[model samples]
Target chain A: MFAIEANGQKIEAKKGETILQTLTRAGINVPTICHMEGLLPSGTCRMCVVEVEGFGGLVPSCSHPVAEGMKIRTNTPEVMQTRKTIIDLLLSNHPDDCLYCARNGNCDLAKLAADNGVRDRTFHGERTHRPKDISSPAIIRDPDKCILCGKCVRMCEEIQGVSAIDFVNRGSKAYVGTAFNEGLNVSSCISCGQCILVCPTAALSEHKYIDEVLQALADPEMMVVVQHAPAVSVSIAEEFGFKPGTDFDGKMVAALRRVGFDRVFDTSFAADLTIMEEGSELVHRVQNNGPLPMFTSCSPGWVKFVEQFYPEFLPNVSTCKSPQQMMGAVIKSFFAEKENLDPKKIVSVSIMPCTAKKFECGRPEMGRDFVPDVDFVLTTRELAELFRITGVNPAAIEPEPPDNPFGERSSAGKLFGASGGVMEAAIRSAYFLLTGEELKEYKIQDLRGMKGSKELRVKIGDLEVGAAVVSSLGQARKLMDEIKAGRSDIHFIEVMTCPGGCINGGGQPIGADQEAIKARMNALYQIDRDDRLRVSHKNEWVQRLYTEFLGKPLGHKSHELLHTHYEKREVLL
Target chain B: MPTVKSVETILKEHPNAGRDHLIPILQEVQESEGFLSQESITKVGRALNLPSSKIFGVATFFNMFRFQPKGKYHVMVCRGTACHVKGSGKSLDMVTKTLKIQPGETSRDKLFSLEIVACMGACGLAPVVNINGQFYAKISPMKLQRIIEECREKEQTHANA
Candidate 1:
């Protein structure tokens, strides 16, 4: 390790670490993507160029190794010129598709291009044109919009350990894609959404559901009920000018009402209900020797990846629909029954931070009692737009309580937004259900926080239950791979698609740096702490739902409405 | 510890390659294996997922990937304004003929992949070639070829045993 003064800040960096890594670790982000932590530094973009005191020329900070006592100026005129030129060069080849581009409003390259004062894409040459690829069930790849930055390449090769795609050609003919231009859906590519998350352009983006949602909201005969995921509460506030990790549950409810949602429910309600079904299923599976390791199926990205790549492990996957879909089913069935609304006329909406939720809602398996469970899925961004277009300022809107039955939930439900939150919530309920007593230790502090990928063991009755938690779709791949290999000792696992879980979802407000993401994750925990009804099982509404309507967890009625099964995708690598 | 030239030296030697083609060369190197094993390729592929094979194909197919294994010594000659004005192309030709490989092709011994890149953006260092990550300025054709020979000899001695 060496210490250096960069931009008047003392930075301690590992030997051979680049200036960009040092600066990023020190929280001074110089725009970069081709320089992820583990990948080789390809200084082709020259975006991280910096001026040094002794060095006469501007150099790419991303490739330059840190040395002891190196005096570096990040914002010199020469450096700025180099950066501006680089941005101009990139913009020349970049397509002006921001308005229609899926990565619009969130792309790093677009943000930087805007920040760097790019007036035009100076080059008047013929634009690179390639067809859009939407064949995959989970992801879409548009070649014409690709900036050819290797972030996706590095993310796949170095991070996810799945070298499914790479830069295939060179010069004016260069492209980033699979071998022989194979469709991503057909290739060994796991639909982890990491590539989508890392792509600097709209070249890679999840299939969107904004149009379907818009149509549903416009249908006069339809009663569209929406539910926001737990993690969405922590992050949706960011879009409304609230800080990341702010628990804007009340404000989000207010915004949904203002957006003219017929009913704004909580997916946490279903997440709590998921615990009731999945937990009971786990106990049955364990006792019956059905599957040793029952993997959580909350993340559609992970589920699709597993179904496609590791089909042999299908038995291990929990059959319960993800809370988003589960809530959809319950909405159309249970809620529709209570309200005496025709099932066909009820359109259940989901406001999720997940791109895969769009895919999950369209699944043929989602229909129950002749009605498709969830009619429309909206990312947090789309929902925010609804509030905006409807002229509802979420910040100024008065906070109000949610509707009856599904409105009242627990802190256990709230924690479902963060990693390990689902596991913790489930254990809180399952342990008590088995022991026939409330857990005296209310704080299951063991399963909490942004610890990256973690594995913990706890004794539930005579059996030692091994549980693991992972955030970040890429990290989940590693955990899933280990579980598939039978090397993972965990009996149950929790996987959240985004890093820091829903608090830092892809559709959340833009510009959440690492610190902001961590802060929002903490806010979710604090929200859990402040709630009096912390355990999902003990929530009065949940108790009544079982005692008054559904009878018991995993019973015939609960299974019909709250619980569902997963279908095996026929694709194999 | 072999006699290695800097990245500048390799670039100076290869006359035909350019800045727009650097990514292709890097991609080719990575595709040959799973990753960019050499630091030169790593530096070259930074910000681009330049699998070496893809880079090589692009380099050769569109004139960019360096087919040569990067020697402990890489010598890149800048064909940018300063270097071009100072006869960087002539220096690159001299290195290429001496090494007996095209701009992107490596020697059979696997010691070096010659590459010609556009402006290092260092207009002051005309006719510049970075050898083994070190900058070598004011290099004529004769001087550039000698650096390649010296690096080749060092690799030969190391491999002889």
Candidate 2:
């Protein structure tokens, strides 16, 4: 470490660390718009400019390595002026419809402008009026609001490994667009929404279904049924000014009731159902010498990723529908029958921590007889907005349990929110299915936390089951290449499209840092630790449903509702 | 005239090409095909293991690449400072009006194509217009009209014959 003077204070700088990293470690605030955590600094925004002692002009601290005996001023008048000028220039061509924008109060550009004291636009120029590309069912691309920081482009290409959009054209004519400037629906976009998570402006956002949901709620003929995903309850608390990872499960159910939903179901229940079906499938594959290394089909984005990029692995993917879809199928069929209500009059809505869930529900295979299982899907952000508009504060509301039947869930089901949670949950139940005995320890220490990829081997009687868990399509690609190379050690693999699983999904609260994601993951683990019902196979309601309606796991009835197939999709690169 | 190579054959030549060879591959394909087609770009992307969006981005960044084929009469209008000062803007407007096609576009009949170039290093000519490798110095609205008419009449006479 070397000593450097920053803002007239002596600070220690680590070897080969950038100026921003060193200063950030010392608790000094340096504002940046284009600098994404854990991503290579592009230094295009020029917002983190700092005055170096010998430099002729302000240097971008994000990319510049700190030198010994260097004197840097982070907030000098000249540096502040430059930062303010950048915001001013960005705002000059930006649209004036912030109030009407989806990210009205949550926009980073607006916050940066306010922080830099850029009260008004100082530069005048001709604004480019590119129409909003509302082609994708999950995401909307508004080029007019884009500041060209290239965060979304880097996120999609570098992190997600799906370069669906890029900087097309050159100079002033350049904008982020898909190949041939075509609709994103035709491009190789998996609707993961990782791009939406990194976007700082209103340029990229989830396609809202809140209006349709509200209209359905107001309809006298429709019975609106809502199910919240496992990751949603823990993360949605952040939207209501609560601390990250605060479990608002009960209060959120209460809010859903206030929002006029006739039934509130927990998607964790469907997660338990998934464990039963997927676990049995794995055991079947292992005993029958069927396909080895069966991939989890729970993540809609990952399923689409396989369909488009890795069609050869389609048979390897478990045919079990996602928890959201499973819940929707059950709600539209079983629940509708139980309540003596017409399936057409029932609006099966789901609250998911995913944008891909929106696309997943729209798939033709997900519905039957011209009626979709899930009529509308709302992201965690959209759910929070719905709560706000309806004046229902989840924090202020009394905690209440979800409705009966599809509401009861095991702690293992709740663990589906995190990266390795699915593998851990499956192992807990898979061991029971194979040997008819529960593992001594329910918590699989090897398969926990926020690592990109994890592997664990379990000995069930004589058969040792090797399992692998991976999040993010990039890590999935690496594992897929290994599987394609004929390295066969794993029996089961769980893949989530967004890194850190659904807790850090594309449709989660924006501006959430790495700490927020970790806290959310920990919150799920904590719930598993505190709850009494820990194993998915032990869920009484799931067992009752099997005996009462569906004959057993992987039965004919289960195949019709809980399982589906995927076809190789042809995309424009 | 050289025989054009198919996209598949061109891709076969660069058997082990990676992302770094994207530009050279794109240039080779564009040279053979006259312009980059969606099929050719997609093939290049598959060969390089790069997304077509990235290829399109890189190709669009450089002005040398075109997406559409050039017409029979490729018109290059010099828009250098010297030519602009000599009323090349009016000549450009005249040509656009006569051809009913903007710069960097071909006419529907495929007879004329327009291109606004920075300079041909022909500043001595002041205002310059080049068609089929033949340069016309001191070009004006009337001169451009007469030249277009001459080309159209030549086409008509050839068709009659």
Candidate 3:
């Protein structure tokens, strides 16, 4: 480390780190817009400009290297003036509709303007008048509100490895768009919503279903039933002024009841069902000399990724429908029959931690007889908005249990929120199915935490089963290449499209940092540790469901309801 | 005349190219095809192991790249400082009115294409226009209309023949 004088303070700086990194490490505030944490700095937005002692002009601290004996003034009058000017210019072209925007209270540009004391429109220019692209069922792209910071573009290309959108044209005329500026539905977008997570403005957001859900709730003819994903219970507390990892499952259920849903179910219950089907499928494939290295199909984005980029591997993906679809199917078919209600009148809505779940439920193969199994999908952020609109404070409400028949879920099912949770859960039950005995330890330590890729080996009676878990599409692409190159040690692979699984999914709270994501993961692990139902096979509801309706795992009835197939999808890149 | 290579053949020529070879490959493809087609861009993207959006982004940042096919009589009007001072704006308007097409657009009959260039470096011949590599100096609105009419008549005569 070397010494540098920053804002009249002597600070130690790392040799190769940027000035922004040094300042951030020193706990000094330096505003930035386009500087994503793990991405290469483009320095497109000059919000972090600092006055260096010997520099002819203001240096962009985010891209400028820290030098020894360099005197930097971060909050000088001229620096503040320049930063304010940047915001003023950005606001000049930006639409002044924050009151009606989806990101009204949670916008970075608005926060920056407020922080910089920008009270008036200091500059005037021709505002962009591009129409919003709302063709995709999951995400919306408002080009008029985009400031061209390229955060969404970088997030889609660099992080997700899906360059569905990019900077088109040049200079002032440039904007982020798909190929040929076409609709996103026809592009290579997997609807992961990672771009929406990184957008600092209201340019990218999930397509909302709140109004439709409200309409369904108000209709006496419609019986609206909602299911919340596992990750959402742990992450939704952040929006309600609670700690990031606070589990608000019971209160969320109570709030949904107050919001007029006829029934509130847990997607974790369906996650348990998914494990039963997927684990049996894995064992069947292993013993019958079926496809080796079977890939998990729980993540809709990862499933779509394979369908588009790696169509040859479609057979390798497990046929089990995702937990959301599983719950939707059972709710419309089994639950409707049990309650003596018409399936057509049942609106099976799902609250998911992913935007891709919106696309997943709309898949033609996921339903039967013209009616969709799931009617609408809402993101965790949208759920929070719904709560606010109805004045139902989840934190203040009394905690209560979810409705029966699909309410009971194993701790292993709850673990599905984290990156490696699925592999661990599968190994726990697969051991029992093969050896008639449980593993010594339920928690597979190798398959925990937020690593992009993880590997483990388990011994079940004389057979050693190899398992691998990976999150994020980029890492999955690498593992897929290795598999194609004939690395044949693995038997089963779990892939989640988001970086840290559904806890840090695209539709989670936007401003959650790395610490918040880790907290959410730990919360899921803690729930698993505290709960007694740690295995899917041990869930009484799952066993009872099999005996009462489905008969057995991988049976004909189970095949009809729980299993689905994927086909090659052609998309414009 | 040289034989124009297909997009696939051009891509096959640079079998081991990386990202840095994108501009040269695009230039070569455009030279052969007159403009970059969506199919050609998609092919270039696959050959270079890049996404089509990124290829489109890079190709669009430069002014020389065109997305549409050029018309038979391509017209370029210079709007340099000298020409702008000499009322080339009127000449451009005249061309737009006569051809019913904007700059960077081709006419419906595929006989004329219009482009507004920054500088042709013909300050001595202020208000200059070029049609199929033939430069006309000291051009007026009337001169531009006559040139367009002559091109249309020539196309008509050639069709009749």
Reference-based lDDT, residue B106, model 1: 66
A1-573 in candidate 2: lDDT tens per residue?
889999999999999999999999999998899998888889999999999999999999999999999999998899999999999988988999988999999999989988879986678889998989999999999999999999989988877888999998888889988998899899999999998988999899999999999999999999999999999999999998989989999999999999899999999999999999999998898889888789999999999889988898898999999999998898888888899988899999999999999999999999889889998989999999999999999999998999879999999999999999888899899888888898898888888888999988878889888889999988999999998998999888999999999999999999899999999999999999999999999999999889988889999999999999999999987
Chain B of candidate 1 vs. true chain B, TM: 0.58
How would the candidate models be sorted by TM-score, starting from the highest?
Answer: 2, 3, 1
Decreasing DockQ order of the candidates? 2, 3, 1
Looking at model 2, the pairs that clash are none
Give lDDT tens digits, candidate 3, residues A63-104.
999999999999989999999999999999998889999899
At residue A377, what lDDT does model 1 achieve? Answer: 72
> What are the iRMS values of all candidates?
7.4, 0.5, 0.7
Per-chain TM-score (chain B), model 2? 0.89
Candidate 2: stretches off by over 4 Å? B93-102, B108-111, B145-161
lDDT of 1 by residue, B43-160 (tens): 4533343433333334344444333456555667788887888888898888777777766566676666677787777778677898767888788888877777787787789889
Q: After superposition, how far is residue B35 of candidate 3 from its true place, in Å?
A: 1.7
lDDT of each: 0.73, 0.92, 0.92
Q: What TM-score would each prediction reach against the true structure?
A: 0.74, 0.97, 0.96
| Candidate 1: residue B32 Cα off by (Å) | 21
User: Which is the leading candidate under lDDT?
Assistant: 3
